[model samples]
Target chain A: MEYRGAPQATLVDLLDRVLERGLVLDADIVICLAGVPLIGLRLRAALAGMETMTKYGLMQDWDREVRAGAQSLQKGAALLAGQAVQPGLH
Target chain B: MMEDRSQGQVQEQARPEGAGGEAGLYVYCIGPALGGGCCGVTGIEGREVDAVVHRGLSALVHPCPVQPYQTANLEVTASWVQAHHRVVEAAWKQWGTVLPLSFNTIIRPEGGLSAADALRMWLEHEEGALQAKLDALRGKAEYSFQVFWDPVVIGRQVAEASPDVKRLEEEVQSKPRGLAYMYRQRLEKLLREGMEARAAQECRELYGRVARCAERVHVSRPKEGQEGQVMLLNLSCLVSTGMVAALEAEADGLSGREGFSVRFVGPFPPYSFC
Candidate 1:
């Protein structure tokens, strides 16, 4: 219900207006890019990339770190077992 | 149409002669020619933004290379978009009314005509229409209104409201395990249909209420909602500045309803209206 202004919180709404809705000029004078579809695709990709980074990128990195830690723990356990066996052989 | 008095003025003022590149005038928005320049606002890439005037209208512009401002970098693109919006917002505040151009709207110089001249001539030709639009949008701003509903809640309500769905729910409960599974799927489908119908009715009622508070309403495609919510209505409303409170009051009422949430943002420079 709060009437939000154009801040970072409303970037999606701002982009919708700035990218899609506005006064269009005659084709002859304006430097027309391919069209809205192309621009929309590019912006959507960029935004999707950003969302992925914010939402899952950190979690993926954390998952890797946790797996590495577990691997190191396993290696330590193997090393301790090897030491225990070496003493028995000696 | 006015004669082109300043043949090289746009080129000279927008960019340095023999700058050895094809540069174009990137227009942000257009407003009534108020004589005084654009309060020294800077636009994309920190380029100084000024106005190209023609018969009581001005197009706020900055000089840039002929290429569109685009990039693979999300941050860069976002910055450009934000800068474009900032300039337009500034113009809107200063000029009292403006017709905002989409992002990266660059006016390139045509054959034998400088970009600035092309802009000026276009403005002259479109003066009547542009002025009419600006007049119509003078005291209004565009607002974004989106309604998201909790699908789980709406689905439950639909199930309780529809007799068919209630009967199926009871049948599913009474049937054998395997048959009950099949009945559950059928029940879900029926509930989904009821939900869609209910959603349509809610949308119509909400649109009617919100439309009354605004001068103009543009229905936009609803987007996917976050978490468990589903977007029901997305609208861009052109509301007179004085009527913003009334619009907010309506939004507040909608948001207060159980299972429904509203996103009402703006006072934007009538971008959709344009």
Candidate 2:
């Protein structure tokens, strides 16, 4: 097969950091989604504490995260149904 | 509240799968396609898991569409879990080329259909994107390897090698920086160097082993990052169903190496293959 752009390694690197082990919801960030907890543990704590960390740079990329979270929600719903992703602004 | 949801089950009469009343959620990978293989596999809810043909392709689901699982406790969720696993297991049968979605991915309910408008809307918006990704991962699967160190073994070796630190090891019992503390630092450094080197070495060898077998190799951290720099190697191999044996054999061989292990978990939808 014709290899695509950047090496596969590069994309995997980005995905690992972005998707697989990205910020998970933990207690500190125990935000709910419909009712279920959005995240799991440690990162949850940090996200829960995001408001408090406004003084710090933790929330520096807040907007981007919200967008990603929103995307995940819709994608999650569709993925649950095994539907293809709906094209978004992204 | 949970009880109410359980009670309000919009269930249909149980029947053998593909009976038309029983439906299943067939999956591909990160992206969805109009149709694909899905052939010669069993459906897995209660009976045989299979696919219910929709568009031109079949969505793999339980052969017995409706699973009449009689459980001891109405409230207990064991049957639900088992039913879901059944779906997953059947999907795995074809997961090599097809990336099966997580269990319970029915966009439409059994004996139901997707909202046409929403389906169209999503397809219109995301079809290209999904297609792009699907095209990208057309033939590949994810693989990983992790290595760990035995700190005890290192300590034993260190104790044997450096006799000079023996007295210091005895003196600085606890508290502030002492002889024992210093010896530990040396051990840590050695471990770091040794493990990292070992990790790198294994990675190079692995890359070489799967060289022709893979279209691409993605290296990620090992499952254990702190002690071991987990090298997650993702390979996009344009493989035939038959070549799985070759991949498995290679992995099995790698597993016999020192301080390392290999895990083979897919034909899973190539999330990264594309």
Candidate 3:
């Protein structure tokens, strides 16, 4: 995963900006590879459009829910995934 | 003509990437002049790269197929992306600041215009704006900073401070099973909200501190990866090349504080700025 210097910019970071942040010249020049829009990759598995979600005041609520789920539901998920049991969970 | 190009696709029996037959220009970035000699960088798919000068500005491009680089197969895609970045990095290393175009930005003959001609025409039209950006970005590079906090660590810290949560935890342990379940739920809810609020507040403060050192600061979406961590701030900053170390030092200082893991990357051509 190493490139010449600087820990080979994380694929997620590079991909996120590669298509999403740059200047778009027009529609005609934009081509899709394998029927998938280059920028269509989601940022993370569960959280989608985090910036947009945050902008509309939705991320805080979602964050709260996700954090709470991490605290409680992670135990069940961990069990299912066969991860080491974390302490202090009933 | 467009129909002809689309229909002329040659199918590769085993390759999944389809046909990339027609030669087109893959535009990497644009800069002022770039002086004499080629950048000596290879473009996507190992194609030899050179610059096309137009009215004092030069574009680093290579003859790539017009087809988009496939994303379905990540291994192939990653190599292409790495190659793309390598070329831009080469250009930046040799010729200071560059306005980087996005990956897979190919220009093919459309509306009877040749690929190079179309590229030249676009450069001509955007010459003034492009030059302005190049001048502004000269001697500057983009750096990325990401701050993440371990949820367990932050939650434990928050709980230690919140008396209400302490009382709830005690109740959860002592009360009847059904009632304790409710209390535990309530406790988890409060802690989650508090930690989220604290992260947001910390993000604002961190961005302010980092912004002072940068000419342009772009706040990006926080990326959540690990199960027990939350991204506090993700920023791409444009700063003078000389100030990058100072910025990293600042990040190092920030990382020394508890519950914060900082990822700082760059000296990259100002991709976000362009």
Using DockQ as the measure, the top candidate is 1
The 10-residue segment with the lowest total lDDT in model 3 chain B: B5-14
- How high is the lDDT of residue A11 in model 2? 22
- Give one digit per residue, the lDDT tens place, for model 2 in B1-274: 3343234233312223554453323232222333454444434334444444433223344322222332222122223433443443344444433333332233333124332232333345555644554455444554432222233343344445554445445554663776667767765555444434433454466666765465555443233222221223433334445566676677666655443344454443343343
**DockQ, all models:** 0.15, 0.03, 0.10
Instruction: Identify the runs in model 2 with alpha carbons over 4 angstroms from their true place.
Output: A1-90, B1-99, B102-117, B124-181, B204-212, B216-221, B224-246, B266-274
Question: What's the i-RMS for candidate 2 in angstroms?
Answer: 18.0
Q: For candidate 1, give the lDDT of residue B271.
A: 88
* Model 1: per-residue Cα lDDT over B1-274, one tens digit each: 0122133223323433355265689899999999777856788868788789998999999877675665544445556778889899999998889999888788888888889998888898999999999999998988888887776776778778889988888888789999999998888678656766677678778888888999999887666554445567788999998999998888888878878888888778898988
- Models sorted by lDDT, best on top: 1, 3, 2
Q: Candidates' lDDT values, in order?
A: 0.73, 0.37, 0.65
Candidate 2 reaches a DockQ of 0.03
Using lDDT as the yardstick, the better of models 2 and 3 is 3
lDDT of 3 by residue, B1-274 (tens): 3332223223211224334455577777777775865577677778788788888888888866676554333334445666777877777777777777777777877678777778788889888988888789888988888776666677788899899988888878889989988898899788866765566567667777888789998876554424554556668899987777777777888777776677787766777887
Range of the 10 consecutive residues with the lowest summed lDDT in candidate 1 chain A? A81-90
If the candidates were sorted by their TM-score against the true structure, best first, what order would they fall in? 1, 3, 2
lDDT of 1 by residue, A1-90 (tens): 323331223556777888888887756787765345245567665543443433433333323433443453353222112122122111
Using lDDT, give the best candidate's number.
Answer: 1
Model 2 alpha-carbon miss at residue B7, Å: 14
